[model samples]
Target: MISILFAVLTALSNGTASVLQRRAAADAPEEDALRLSLLRDLLRKGIWIGGIAMSAVAAVCQAVALATGPIAIVQPIFVIELPFTLLLGGLLFHGSFPRSVWLAVAAVAGGLSLFLLAAAPSGGDASVTTGFWPEALLVTGLFLAALLAVGLRVRGNARAATLGLAAACGYALTAATMKDAMARLDHGVGAFFTGWQLYATAAIGAGSLFVLQNALQAGSLAASQPMLSIGDALISTCYGVTLFSESLRTGWWLVPQLAALALVLAGCIGLSRSPLADGLAPRPDDRPRTDVPAAV
Candidate 1:
């Protein structure tokens, strides 16, 4: 129960942070998007600072949740972050929250509950084999590099969605690595530093932030949020099963799980179309202009 509570709190913190961070990043001076210049500019914004603080809180809460619960259980719970973002973003922007969005939120809640209860994920090892480490690192690194390359080549909503998915992949890999490193805390602080997962988590986390900033800068929240939410859920589930050796109910139970996935997807789609999501995008006048003045 404590783990569940912490996961929920983590979702709240992360959701609110997304809105704050994007607001600051969107207002930053035009530059190479997601470059150090944009980051330096956003660092001066109070809202961005508050967003970073919230993200830190979320990370702490997530670590606590992971320590106490299976990765499958803790990570899937983060799907609620999208709905929470819609709620908080609406409140922050004074936008009217729609009934359909609430219905979608309720569907997500019910679907997650039904899916988790049916799946009953269990069994995980605290330590990964040495050989597995190289494989895991290589696969994740290749995937992220491909995603970044493709995302950087796009523009507008497509760019946002692609970069958001890349961020999601980074976040999923980070969570898996973080779980591995945190498990070493049982041995002592020295053990944690000795583990390569700790370093990988830091590197991936920094990359995720860079990708996320570009995602936000590329387009509206609607373009990024659904991709980020859905991609994280899918990748994290695979990581939990593969890396942690966690098991979910198979055979007959797969049907309900599939249905639950459909429900979650539907909810995410609905919320992405909400007024609150629209508000998250910069106003037309606020967008960076590329038009040069007419030659005098």
Candidate 2:
């Protein structure tokens, strides 16, 4: 229960950070996309700095959650970040919530609930062996490289989605490494600082943030957010199972699990199409002048 609570807090913090960061990223010059210059530009924006602070909070909460529970359970809970982002965005930008927004929120929340109940992931090792790190890192690196290449070749929404998936992969690896590093605390603070996993987590997490910024700059939030939210949950689950030996019900339980996943996918898609989610709805200032006479 403690882990679950922390995970929920992580999701909420991440959602707020995404909204603020995306707002800042949207104003960056196109030439800065996918470059260190993007970060330099973002640093000038107070909103981006605020977002970074929220991300720091999320990171701490995530570390606590991973230490206290299986990664499979903790990571999947982040899917709620999607609804939280959209809802928060709506409130912050538009100051109104549409009916569809509420419905999409319900769908995401309900589907995630159903999936967790069906999967019931549990009983993972607190730490991974050093021997497994090489293979896991190699595979993850290659996959991220491929996605980055694809993202560079694309434009608009395609670029956003591709980079979003790459960021998701990076984040999953970060969580896995963070869990491994946190487990080292069981030894001693000295041991924790000595563990290579701690440094690796910081490096990977920084790279993920860079990719996520490029994703936000590439196109609309609707294009990137679904991939980010869903991809993270699924990829982290794989890492949990393979790296930490976490267990989930198989056999007949797979049926409900798949169904639940479908529900999540559908919900994500529906939310992505929402006007509020994409910032397509007209704000008070954006509304056209109604008092003007027809020129015809």
Candidate 3:
């Protein structure tokens, strides 16, 4: 119960921070991008840096949650964050969500819960060996390469989704590293290159977030967010299982996971179909334009 509550609070904080950061990014003048102001550019400093600081706090809380809770329990409850994210955009940013989006969110929530229920218990003890480094790094490299290539080839919302997927890969690999870090906390691996995994995790986690916000800032949140949620959950879950030794009880567990994946796909599709979107149109705006004759 405590762990779950902590996860909820963390997710809420995370969502709020994400929305604020996105808004700030959306409104920022490109000329002043992260520049140190001549005088006291308190607004710039606060909007950019402060939002990031709050996100850092949320990240720490999330890391703690992952360190303590079962992946199944933690990941599903974290999915509530997707709804909360859209809710934040609606309330604070004046963004409106369509009915189908709500339905998809509801479907995703239900499916994710069922997925968790069908999974094995995982909150006991986690220990990972340094021997797995080769396998972990190889898989991480593969995900990185695939996502990067996909991100480059795509445009607009699809590009954003690919970038988010890349970020997820980084984050999940970092989670695996964190597990290794936790294992080496008391060891003398600190003075030299003994705890590469720990620092690698921190670097990956932090870097991925930076990339995530940049990707979000490049396009519509509705278009980008579903991918973020689904990708993050999948990456984190796989990290738990593959690198951190988390597991499922039975083969039947795959069924719920696939069902949840379908729900996630539906949610993404619903978000894409929103009236707020420009549809398959190239431009970001949905306003009807007067058809002007081409120059002779």
- Runs with alpha carbons beyond 4 Å of true place in candidate 3: 27-45, 97-99, 121-125, 186-194, 275-296
Tens-digit per-residue lDDT, 231-254, candidate 2: 999999999999999999999999
- Worst 10-residue stretch by lDDT in candidate 1? 287-296
- Cα distance off (Å), candidate 2, residue 133: 1.0
- Note each model's CA RMSD in angstroms: 4.1, 5.3, 7.3
Query: For candidate 3, lDDT tens digit of each residue in 73-181?
Result: 5654666666777666666544566787688667767776666767754744455665777887887898788877776666667766777677767766665666556
Using TM-score as the measure, name the better of candidate 2 and candidate 3: 2
Question: Which of candidates 1 and 2 is the stronger one according to TM-score?
Answer: 2
Look at candidate 3 and tell me the lDDT of residue 28. Answer: 35
Clashes of each: 0, 0, 0
What local distance difference test score does each model get? 0.84, 0.90, 0.63
Residue 239 CA displacement from its true place in model 3, Å: 1.5
Model 1 CA lDDT for position 11:
85
| TM-score, cand. 1 vs. native | 0.93
Error (Å) of candidate 2 at residue 169 is 0.4
lDDT for model 1, on a 0 to 1 scale? Answer: 0.84
Best by TM-score: 2
List model 1 lDDT by residue over 176-238, tens digit each. Answer: 888889999999999999988899888888889888988887888888877887788789888
